[model samples]
Target: MAPISIRNNPDRLRYEVLDGDLAIGQAAYVDDGEGRRIFYHTVIDEDYGGQGLAGRLAAQALDETVAAGLMIVPVCPYIKNYLGKHTQYADNIQKPTPALLTVLNNALARRTRR
Candidate 1:
């Protein structure tokens, strides 16, 4: 299998698959006063679902966020679950707040659009 490529699109706050030419996963975030607060809403296309693409994307996103020194707010159910299983990323997780939830919801809406 070809290696997966994750590219961060700052304009859309999403990390996409460059090799597959497919948007295998994405995360949403908002610029808070301190830093970017990421909320992952990742989805692997059905054809790619079982291949560990989502995890890879999420891991890359977390890695990038850490590199940038940004905190995260994992509002996406998948992300929440994934993080629950991956304690190593806990330090990067930001505590969720009402405002952050609003931001996450809005970002998700934008992502659903064409």
Candidate 2:
């Protein structure tokens, strides 16, 4: 089995999960520019399914976001559901707001334009 690693790729506004040197999954988010990371989506390649990579990715991303003194805004259903079962991040979670959704939407639109 290949080793797994997770990293924040701020340039791309996402956290990438790697199997050795290959990217196998990603959790996408946008910084609200106000101490919040609005997570919008997460996915693992079908080939790598059933390995718990999504959980690992969520844990690492949420951990790092808290460590950085940022709040988590889980717009993605997976992330929201993960938080429902994990209380550690309860204090750091911010419910999604319309303004935050705008932030995420604008960021995604900009990315698509590029």
lDDT for model 2, on a 0 to 1 scale? 0.94
Tell me each candidate's TM-score: 0.78, 0.96
Q: Please, what's the RMSD in Å of model 1?
A: 2.9
Best by TM-score: 2
Tens digit of per-residue lDDT, candidate 2, span 12-111:
8899999888888999999988899999999999999998989999999999999999999999999999999999999999999888888888988988
List clash counts for every candidate, in order: 0, 0
lDDT, residue 112, model 2 = 93
- Assess candidate 2 and give its TM-score to the true structure: 0.96
lDDT of 1 by residue, 27-108 (tens): 6556554676656567766766687777887788888888888887777787888889999988888878887777766766
Q: Give Cα distance to truth, residue 94, candidate 2, Å.
A: 0.7
lDDT of each: 0.74, 0.94
